[model samples]
Target: MANEIFICHNCPMTRTMATIGTKWKPIIIYTIGLKQQRFGLIHAKMGLISKKILTEQLKELEEDGIVKREAFREMPPRVEYTLTDKGLELLPILNLLTEWNSRHHQADFK
Candidate 1:
């Protein structure tokens, strides 16, 4: 038989983690937030992520169907990213994780 794509231990949660478990992926998603964001603006907001890494991460997110990337044909050229329906589904989960972290580390959170 063909190799099973996911064993019993590797389930949907594991798949989700595989998709967004990177150190920067979640932060990227949160930074994008509710509105579409341009590449330069996102880089400015993130500050720490190098341009190369950000580009790679955005490509991955776009490939995974979690982020939509649109390019405009204009003089300088422009691109924007927004969360897809699948990505929007993750917002509540990310919020809950934030709430949990705040609850556990009350001193650090405001």
Candidate 2:
């Protein structure tokens, strides 16, 4: 039974990478975590990602169940992106990765 379960499921790391393997996904997640929900705010926070790429990434994240996109019907139409529960669950892991990178490569960031 255990072997069957293992065979039925993807390796955790592989599954994680499939969801957020790209160089920009984690940064996008972190930016959303910071309450920068609007498209413009996220684009501004990233500073270098082209709008097209950011839009693509956001779409992928939304499809993967890691982010939620809500559109408000109003005069100008406001859209916001927020992390889903699944994405919230990844924050601690992201924080650990950030801390590990900082500890090992402090000079690079400075």
TM-score of each: 0.86, 0.84
State the lDDT of candidate 2 residue by residue for 1-110, as single tens digits: 99968965777777888889999999999889946398888999899999999999999999999999999898788889999999988888899999988898987777
Cα error, candidate 2, residue 104 (Å): 1.1
lDDT of 1 by residue, 1-110 (tens): 23465463477878878899999999899999899999999999999999999999999999999999999998799999999999988888899988998888986665
Best by lDDT: 1
What lDDT does candidate 2 reach at residue 102? 85
Go through the candidates in order and give each one's C-alpha lDDT. Answer: 0.92, 0.90
Off by over 4 Å in 1: 1-9, 107-110
Question: Lowest-scoring 10 consecutive residues by lDDT in candidate 1?
Answer: 1-10
